[model samples]
Target: MSDQSLLRERWLPGVRELSFGGDYNPEQWPREVWAQDLDLMRRAGVNLVSIGIFSWGLLEPRPGEFDFGWLDEVIEGLHAAGIRVDLGTPTTVPPQWFWQQNPHVRPVMRDGTVLAPGSRGICCPSSPEYAEASLRITTQLAERYGKHPAVALWHVHNEYGAPVSECYCEVSAAAFRAWLQARYGTLDALNTAWGTTFWGQTYGDWSQVGAPAQSASMSNPAHRLDFARFSSDELLGCFTRERDVLHEMSPGVPVTTNFMATNCPSMDLWKWSREVDVVANDHYLTAADPRSQVGLALDADLTRSLADGRPWMLMEHSSSAVNWQPRNLAKRPGELARNSLSHLARGADAILFFQWRASRRGAEKFHSAMLPHAGENSRVFREVTELGATLWSLTDVLSSRVQAPVAILWDWESLWAQDLDWRPSVDLEPRRQVREYYERLWHDKVTVDFAHPTADLSRYAVVLAPASYLLTGEAAANLTAYVEAGGHLVVGPFSGVVDQDDAVHPGGWNGVLRDLLQVSVEEVLPLPENAGVTLTGGTRAGVWAEDLAPQDAETVLEYTDGPAAGRPAVTRRALGGGTATYVSTVLDHHALTAVLDPVLERAGVTIDRDLPWDLEIVSRHGADGSEYVFAINHAGAPVDLPVEGVDLLTGEPCTGSTKIPAGAVRVFRR
Candidate 1:
């Protein structure tokens, strides 16, 4: 299908996310249980099941291993029963034999020490031995099963980022230096890029410039930031090589791997998402903390947006609660359902529960899955079944769904560089400002596509780059072109401070943006914790404010008090057909709208007319150019979104206004 055609599908369309399925281990269960599951699927609408996430031990028990006996039979059984299957590569970790024998699959740290691997993801991307071994094994699997019609999709390396291992080993150190050499070229360039001259630290030779890190040694914030970038690139390299093989071999089947929320630091996601044809990710948050849960949702929307505003899938979610945190907490009754539905509302294509069947024994043995230890009679099972049925019934309506026109850019490097810098104040976090901007934007019924800051901005009418702390020359040029093309731009405070190398650019920080916005920073004001200011009739304040002087820009909002008081807090510059807007202070939800709404409207954009807080709406025109507007309610309370069209899911006649109940969605056609 064409990219535009794929962009128009729904995540759950006709299928229900009965969130009850667990790791389906038909291998462990008898044929009778398989029969029971078939009946169970019919009753609950369990149209899809994920097979073999943490089954490495079973799939590969010995060296040069090959054991798909049980997996093959399990898949055959599911297909025969008419249940779709999402297959796993089972490459989460090498078999003990491979790691033991090759010794090269292990990841290294910055201190140049090698790590022994029995745990998952110990493979080093740069290691020739690892690339050689994995190539043979993965290629073998792809060749065998790439054409299987029974396989809905292949899950590559389940949850690639947990247990946080950074390869600081000698191999990694060598790779890091080489990467640095490529990036900086000389010790003088490296010293300039790292600002090491400040501490009287200058490299004398290539060997003197270690892999900018302190993993097992004294952790340098700046070095850690560089290491994080390198690590993300390394993982991306691994994924790209494997995916190219799959794309060439299994072009018919859609492929995806799950992403953890943005909290993962080992890699930069903006670069990572480019490798996947389809973006897939897992969504979870601490239910006990309201603030935390909300943050996770925003992150998920960003994740879905990474595929250039295309809707994405929720590959894994908790069935009831989880077992891996410092404190294990079960989701409140109905909360899991609520979370799943919210994902659909935000443009998720599928809702997948992590494991189909709970583990009998393992680290995740006690984790919640659809069939509890007692089997299918459990309450979780019933909930799962009901949800599955709900999804199955509405598959056509939800598939091929599309979201809004506005997208947010979430750059991991920008975030890390912002955090690592020795800024004037400790109260401000770059991520905080970005998330707050999104919260308010969502509240306004704006659909956000999250992607690398350098992604094409032309796809969005109004692009938001909240706290783009690290701005590469390439990214700045792209944004410059975007504004010049008449796209509305809203940049948060503290943007354009550093270049791609994590060093301050002498061209007045924001570099090209300073020229585009027609503004230059006189200084960065470090405010006291409670210090704040109001601009444009209301209070607006946050961690720290950028003190800006307009070159040719028009001041929109000004700080209320202090030395920088009465100065401009928000500025706008006209470039080509579009406007470049910069905010000096972070605003609350109410204030953010006051600044952004006008700009979006001036661009002739419409915010989803005052819907409920949890309601998210999106519209799409199919390949035939048939128009569809999706109304999804994510809250427990029923809400009305006034519109005129037929309900695609229910076959109801055109209602003057659509009334969506709690956890329901309405796809309408004119």
Candidate 2:
């Protein structure tokens, strides 16, 4: 089958409209309340709901004992109400009885402190006992509900490797040793790859190799990086075991695990995306930052790209405010619809919340839900119903795909290596640098898709790689070949400095891609926290400055006056049939705009129109050759959008310029 067909089969099968609703915890309330929830769900247009995510204790109550009585009623009630179900495997939160019996299965921190059992995801991924118990529960659930008409998808586990990403116990160490042995057959090969000869830490036997735990000083960087990879793999192993059980018992039912947006540092989602049948993500706004919801859009866009730009599911997001942040603030009048529509505009076929009903008591009692604490009379519920109707009106846009001409490079190894100690500047975080470039493109109204280092670049016009710290030979060659084959490549500062083993290149920094960019770094000048310098074109540079010289490239921007005056801040070179641009410092917003504008123009990237910072536009091409333009206003004031098309929501012709209200969405079909 084709990729589009696979996406529809896994995510959009049997759903004529976009799937809605979220975690519906009927166990949290009495049986009488279930009927009320079904009524409210229908009134709110909720078609699907995720059930039994953390009900392991309630489902099993004792070792080797199971009870499916309550869940049977819950599923039957929902199915009778015409609501499909995403049945969770209930493995994230192991039951209290199992943990009390097998206490060794609990996770141990790097500091050797065992985590308590009060929170979710406290079980160790490497524990065989934990895996056995989890599989037992999974098999029972799948066998009982496999043939049920309500069952649509299998949720393996909730947010794998969140707080319990790494464990320092002996089981984890043994697993790490086994993983390393599988990667490198002999100890000599392992020692060479880890660069253990430098620190006189070479090991003689596999038993001597262990996880990098707390010590008086910093541990080996390569060891830590490998341990991180092992932990993520272990978690994936647990998920796959449960998934296998479900697939054996229930044929033809797609499986998925909800991914937390960009927040999961341990698991490499790029690898995990291939394991599941469909991609689903959970996202919440950074309420403390108070920025526009554009950052949330960034998360959705990255998730969609992870699924190869096919439509995915927005599994969980708060209707208003989340309770976990330092300060939880409610959303304004139209911010809810704006946030939901932004995700759909990118590539989401479903938009759901963290919960359907508010919690009466728990850690997340204050977290907003579709049915707020005030019940149906609340503003949150009003917006929820309105957004449901609006979403239902866009049924024609289902199975559409996003087309992006620009791609951003996201390397998990680079992120892991960049966070290690003894960097040039602490401000040079990989995510921060990538976000800087992404926000610049967002303000320019340029749609972008994220690509891994090894992803095919034949379709993208421009590829921006920021902080390419850990450059493998293969990755370096892949990037160089792209530029040589007529693709515009932009390299950020501090890139190409180190190899995969955390070892610096022999020559100057950025030596690997030096020939491609035609530039060499003489020395790195770390500016003061608040210091900045300007280039000849009035472009500003801050955080870091590199003393660079052009070998075969021409200097595009040079510093005017500073400690490193008359030095090149940005350089450009023309290769085979394309151009390569190298940025030597962290550029401010104006400077980033100044740098990207010409590159985008040269690449023939389309912006649709010059949009204000508060307005955003994203287009989708339908399977039947129709075009959809989703224009959203994130600002608080009215703005005139210089685009016209047929309004799909109202069937009105929008001509010349269209005025968009604050936090409103306009869907145009052209």
Could you tell me the C-alpha RMSD of candidate 1 in Å?
Answer: 4.0
lDDT of 1 by residue, 1-670 (tens): 7632342333322334322243466666677777777776667666577777557667767756778887787788777876777766666676677776877657655455667775676677677776665566567668877887777666677676666446766677778888888877887777776667665666787776565554433344556677777777777776666766776787556666778766565666666676666677776676556555467568677776665556677777877878876777776555565566567655566777766667787677878876667677777777776566555554543434455567676777777776764566677677777778777766676766676667777878888888787888888888889989988889887788877776676766466578888998878877787876666686666667777889999998888775577789889998999998998776766678888889889887777656777776656544555566766566778887788877766778776776788766666776
Name the candidate that leads on TM-score.
2
lDDT of 2 at 354: 86
Q: For each candidate, give its TM-score against the true structure.
A: 0.87, 0.98
- Per-residue lDDT, model 2, residue 68, is 92
C-alpha RMSD of each candidate structure in angstroms: 4.0, 1.6
* lDDT values, one for every candidate: 0.70, 0.87
Candidate 2's residue-wise lDDT over 1-670, tens digit each? 9543464355545777888888999999988999999999999889899999999999999988999999999999999999999999999998888878998877889888988898997787899899889989998998899878899888988988776788889998999999999999999999988899877999999999988988778788888888887888888898889987887788778888998858787788899888888899998888876564768878988999888887899999989989988888889998899999999999999888989999999898999999999999899999999888888888888889899999999877788888877788887778988888988788777889998887898799999987788887788788888888888989999998888778887667888888788899888888888889888788788888889978999998998977679988899999887889999888988888788888888889875445678788888998787789988988878888766788888989988888888888999987
Error of 1 at 645 (Å): 2.8
| Whole-structure CA lDDT of model 1 | 0.70
